[model samples]
Target: MLRATSLSIVLLALCACGSRAPAPQAAGVAAPDARGPTANAGNHAFQAAITADDFAAHVQALASDGFAGRGPGGIGEDRTIEYIKAQFARIGLQPGNGGDWFQTVPMVETTADESAVLGLKVGQTVQQLTFGDDMVVGTRTGQARVSLQDSPLVFVGYGVDAPERDWNDYAGIDVRGKTVVMLVNDPGFHSGDARLFDGERMTWYGRWAYKFEEAARKGAAAALIIHDTAGASYGWDVVRNSWSGPQYDLPAKDDPAPRLPVQGWISGEAADALFKAAGQDLAKLRAAAGRRGFRAVPLEASASLQLASRSVEKHSRNVLGLLPGSDAPDEAIVYMAHWDHLGTHEGGTGDAVYNGAVDNATGVAGILEIAEALRAAPKPPKRSVLFLAVTLEESGLLGSKYYVAHPVIPLAQTVAVINLDAMAPVGKAHDITVVGKGSSQLEDLLKVAADRQKRRLVEESHPAAGYYFRSDHFNFAKAGVPALYIGSGSDLVEGGIAAGEAASRDYNEHRYHKPGDQYDPTTWKLEGIVQDLEAVRSIGETLASSGQWPNWREGSPFRAARDAMRAASVGSR
Candidate 1:
């Protein structure tokens, strides 16, 4: 999860609509045991390997203020990597990247000047939108100075141009040298119509990254998404906090995607005001935009913005450790988590350290614990198990992207990827929420493991949030690897589903992507996390031992990529 400056209203609405918070815990009330169904499961050897104490210890050390939030390219990165490497060594795993524990990811860091402003003009009336409040803008063009003067503004609906779905928001419109404004998510989300863009479930087209790329390909001077708490899956505060910090991206020369001069997000209130100034109703436009054959509308106003930025080139490392397979060492299973977060942002109130306790400290720690468990197993996995703690994930999955480009093991031989990111602090539950649940056969293996724990598997509670595409695993998925992302369930045994849902809402509102994400052993229920880890370990072991090569589901977007890779492999053999 990306850092946010404000609490998300959409997050609140979704949580409330689906499940209300459970009753508050009385002072000094003990939390549930971290030992879930695994304690009595048939797989005694596997269950005995993961422990609550070990998991809690890892999170506490990684999330502690001593690491300075684990920001990539910052001093924190140095500490985080060394810590992960030392842990892997302690567990007796070999260095994964050809005798080296680290893989260098080249990046360019850009920090926009705080004084930048977005200027809007309609006739003689001029409104200047200040940075961090009315809007958040930046330049990914690798230019120190960027400007757009008197550029005409156009509303491009969701800014999606998917010919496969017969949807094109920019039809019959020339957006060259113009500023394109669009909604945050896809059509089906706003209209609640199943026929439009995966119904309520968000597709890749709805992501902010896709919006900017599509706008740039269409030759727009800038692309700005109108942020709504419900639509963006985050609050205006989140937009501000995330965009204002130092931004990292692959070196422009390395990145092939066309990028616009300016890309950012505008607060919902600001977008509505702009709509009114242009003689259109924001709500009405959204409704019409969700329908088929909607045309892009030109706003009667013009927008101008100048951004001044400072740039630096640096290299961050991806920490990798391997438990080489005793049998087929070339074939592998990968477990990954990002080891970076929003570094120290001086602008934050109270505490400036954006301690990402849950955002990713938990992920890094979880993988480390999993590594230890695998090392202690009675028999080594038949396929190599690579533990990857990547850097710059908060900076748009750059490290993972780089790894995929320069893989330690060929993508074709890799069996599957299991990613853990921003795990919740809630304790054991009756089920596990698998993000992007139906995409591949990996879930089938997960179901077998979950069944052993006497638990069930459920889809992500908030599919509309588009979390499946938000983490490091997406890079692997795009590379034809079947990736699995699961989280602690919201079906708490103590407070039941109500309690579980309440815990989740509380984290999204107060802790997610914020400095408030500090670890609290006094109240934390690691049993649930430990339970989840055991299941993940079980899945990896099963895949490693079996001859089955899990494939993507029939119509999954990544299916063709996997199929082509498999066919090519067979031809090569």
Candidate 2:
């Protein structure tokens, strides 16, 4: 990340149409007696204090090769945590986690041996599936060796058990000690009928994480997700790259949720061949699964796999810095970004470093730039602002989930959580995209802020991808806290929607989760990131100064948790 020297320079060079002035500052720290400022004062200072160069400088440092992709429990983790801590100190922020800058997150790293092959038996024919090319498998049970021999394979469509939706794919089927083969997303996603499981919008049920969880709940010995590019959003290469490395998760004891002995994904070709051997057509079966009242079907096959893995217990650090509220010190607003990435590849070809520049380095840099702006403001926020950089987001948001369970501040006192992930370096846009829109009341506050910048708030364009549940903010949402996750819109102010879409497509296909995602100062346009940071700052400032507590909207899955928490608080008082 590089910091722009002057707003005037940015306006002249980056913003061809028009630009706003960077925030003004007095430079020195505020007096001890100085009270927190009103929303308007903090908003004004934040507008001028945030600059393009500062954002770039932070991203450049975090995404640098010296950090080694910011892998957890390695040299990269040590350097990444220290860098964030130093930035917090330089910004004059206090420790957020009870006078400590670090919170230790316990995790278990499991690295599977790739030489192993999966056995799929159909009638008299048995096929061996290659590791990376045909399939990928790993065990979350934390065992050194796991085996599923001659386990009956059953095709469970979508593998969702949502009682509220009155749909149960596992109804009347006993999958104990069996292997479940399921689709990537939910039923309605493929059909595009809103009446069928929320239509195009992906519920939590559609996510791969949920699919595995549901399979385990039904006592399945193992689970395998059939890969479909349109359904999964990314190609099979993404699945291969993500699952091939050492996978990290909260220790088995730490998470009491049921887990299958083996969880994996198979390539489309492999799935098609298996289905053909079972005397069924994969495409036709997928179509039938989308409709209501679909039952689980036995595939007339068995799956056998022996997963050999080395499991080690390790500790990862979550870096936190606090700007304590002058009035309501205990109540807070949180800004989060994940500092961990794919790290360096151990046994691979070509480029080894999976430098997650746009994936998260930009997000970490963006939050650091915002923290600096908040520190430089004339007055502090009435409610504390916590700048949290978590670990293991790529590993199922484990760091954030741990923080939610063991919060630095009580969830009830926490006002809101704003998460920034993968802010594209594309230039200014006509609007901002709010992932998981219409889930909570925080969007109302975001709308007001976006309107002030003459920008509109648009729902995420790819709902089937379930981008909302894919980020750290989802942990907060699941725990009853209203959270907002937004990114630079794909409708560029200069080139319009087509240009913005092209950049998005290019990143997702060519650079995302790959070694090509390196920091290139030559081509990056940070003016748009600056714009996004300004809007994010305004939203946080408004919530920090106000007394209102935002909640999930009616009918939201999280609404009940918020209501129950409120009722319990009242009963205690």
Candidate 3:
């Protein structure tokens, strides 16, 4: 899981959101037998192999304080990958990456000096904003000292430039060498207007990563997104915690995305004060920015920042294990989960290890259990199944991104991706929440599997948070592979939505990304997660056993890429 960077606190409001229509069932698809996969004795064997006890054991071992929170490039990472490799070997999976169990992902880890401050000069007065309080900034250039001098600031509405939507915030303004200030999310979010950019449901443009990328493309010297709880979907504390530590990025040769010299978030209070100091009303500008044809607003201020950072170049590993197919071994199905989390906080008071028990010790355990089940089955599928436990997800999905770039199997021949992240342990539920539902045929497969369990599939309660783009599957999705990410549904079979909501809220407020996220067997429940793993495993098994090439649905942003790749694959043959 990627922490609060994309997980919405709005998930806590699942109960209050009222009734959501059931996800559209895949047409003409017959549900599997509810008694389990009994047609083939092998299928039944695999199903029986996935048990609550085994899943719990994996979680316990991975989330144990001895793992040191599984931080990438640390001792925790060493133990974590070795543990995964050992498990894979025990389960009879072969090395997936060219006869090697590990794929080395080169990364540059940069930790910015937190004592640095952002200085805003409006007219003759200079207002200084403290780091971690008023603003959080970092440099991707891998520089020790990144300085900006008197860079003029321009308020770019949502920092979006979608020509298809007939909207451009930087239409007449050249932001080159200037600081581009923007609001969080996209134009449609705050306005409540479905006519604009997918309405409340966030598009790719709404993500902060997108905003920064667009700003970098425009030659901006610096980019600052004004943070609001509703817009970013998390609080300033999340931003502070996530950004305050060492940030990781792939080497330039590997990732080639436009790099920003400096970029970060500004608190709403700080943004308001800055806007007022520049003789602009933050509220009014926000409202105006939501409307179409909104132009950039140049603030009467210049910004200067001096950032000092400690940079370390290191290599992380993505642990891979393969169960080769009987027929089409080259064609593959991928089951992935991020294995890294916020590691032990140096010099912290108490309970420093961010165990990430739910954020994703659960997810890693999930794939392991699924792998065990498949490996124990009487027969292998026609297409290979790859169990991937990736690193640096907390840093930004870096491991998965690298894998997609340099894959063991070509992206064109890849069947589909099933991602498990932050699976809620809220016991058995009546339904499962599909993050970014209706985007692919994978959901249809999931729906059929859910039907077998007497459960329904439902859309994530808060789509505006863009949970789809948050996880590792997103890297595969962006590359045109059909990817599915599902979280445990809040509609618990015992307590319904209310209990689910309460649990979600408690996790978000108290434990999420904190030391409080330790594994507690006393309180932890595994039945629901077992069901989730089995359901997703069914989807993977179905894909592996057949020749189906699942794809992104029409109108999906990733559809074009998928169509192009498939076409090219056919033409190449």
Candidate 4:
């Protein structure tokens, strides 16, 4: 659901957490307050409020062709946000942002000219690579015409500069005014060494966004990532398709992290060719790059590319609806889902719209259902609940990023964030998949809730793909707010794990990101998603009622940030 990413592989390999009976509390973990009168009342009301028919109805409408795929900065966005706003109002939610239901997100959209080819000159052997086949390039400079003339090419392995981990790919290398090429994922992945940067689990450093940011920080003129299916977790087609369309970003003023004049991905074959021309073996160099103290390799090749692009400044809205608490109104629990998908492809042959039914229409509908349950409860939560339907998630999570920067409630006061994205439609399951498990105490509460439902919590099967970092919750996690993102388990109650895996594989191969991702009433089974929503509601209700603030785990990268923020708040008080 997070742009061109897919979780079918992870789902296919899902393993059960053993027994289906109510699980006992693990050693030293506190049992959740599951038996509280208020919680029970809320749970009972939740079951009544959240219905499969209602969820299916919402998804059907949102993913219908009339919404035109819910693209931001288009007619689809207008209809989509208004539908969400109308639903919130119907459910008795107050406008969240200063009496306004929408928060304006300023964006810069750049559509590159796909006809432009990447020119490479390795010692007078000029190789003109075709776009969309050999490589795909774009610029974030917001300039009309971007041109580079024979810049020196350097291979900065992974392009990571992490002093805390004592791994610096750019160490002792001056890549200023040159084009730097890097490998996807991190050294730990290729090396299979647990000692290097979280091993298979991708750190933020492994993300392509981070690679470009680090490249820009090192004064590189341009950056290119070598695309491999294993490292990138998707095929070259995904890279091409995702990068081909109009790319959106927060305005330079709003997001001042860094920018790249040119950034894109090249196929593995293209990389091998370039390396061979430069008198280097890509495989050997890739192996060397994974080792500690690996220096930057000078390719002895120069690269040139001219990207001509059309740019536009536009504004999209983040739809917010609030259910105010009776007591602690300032404190809040946030449930969010992106309300955008790949818009209609104009001038295309057939089936242009990418109706994101399971991709995120399901998620949006999920929040709406959860909102109804919360509002229907006999006793309201002590802390407020905010239902946020954000935009531009397909374009690098710009909406959530902006909300984190400019929140209606302060991050210190915000309790936790629960994100729902791409809920599977494969019926009921015996378990639920917790993305980025063991990151926070929220999972402890989730486990308790699962146990109550005769279900168990299982970690994502593929950690190397970095599924945790791919969604909207990652932004909240970066800001030190404990966040939880759970997926429907692959072990179906009726047909078991094999059937679930088959369903996931079918979706991955045929419908994911394609026009076929439409809502189908005949085939879709909403029982599993309903269960997932119930579990999420339980977590939110628990946190909202209690004064307890869930914190990141002891060894998590986010723990320090949470500790600092809490300490500062206390000192200020």
**What TM value does model 3 have?**
0.92
- Tens digits of lDDT, candidate 3, 436-472: 8789999899989999999988787677877777778
Model 2 over residues 404-443: C-alpha lDDT tens digits? 9899998888888999888878788778877777888988
- Model 4 scores worst on lDDT over the 10 consecutive residues at 14-23
lDDT (Cα, tens digit) per residue for candidate 4, span 515-554: 7988998999888888888999999999889998999999
After TM-score superposition, what is the CA distance of residue 399 in candidate 1 from its true location, in Å?
Answer: 1.2
Reference-based TM-score of each model: 0.91, 0.91, 0.92, 0.92
Checking candidate 3 for backbone clashes, the offending pairs are none
User: How high a TM-score does candidate 2 get?
Assistant: 0.91
The global Cα lDDT (0 to 1) of model 1 is 0.79
Model 2 alpha-carbon drift over 4 Å, by segment = 1-48
lDDT by residue for model 1 (1-573), tens: 222111111222121111000111222222222343122112222223678776766777677666667777655677678878878887889999998999999988888887988998877777789998998888887799999999999999999999999999999999999999999888999999999989878898988888899999999999989999888776777677667757878887777888989998888888888899888999999999999989999999899988899878888999999999988999999999888876565532476565677767788878988888888889888899999999877778788999998999989988999998777666778888788889999999899889988888887766778877778888999989999988777677777777765665677778766678888988887887788888998888887887779999999999999989988987999
**lDDT agreement of model 2 with the native:** 0.79
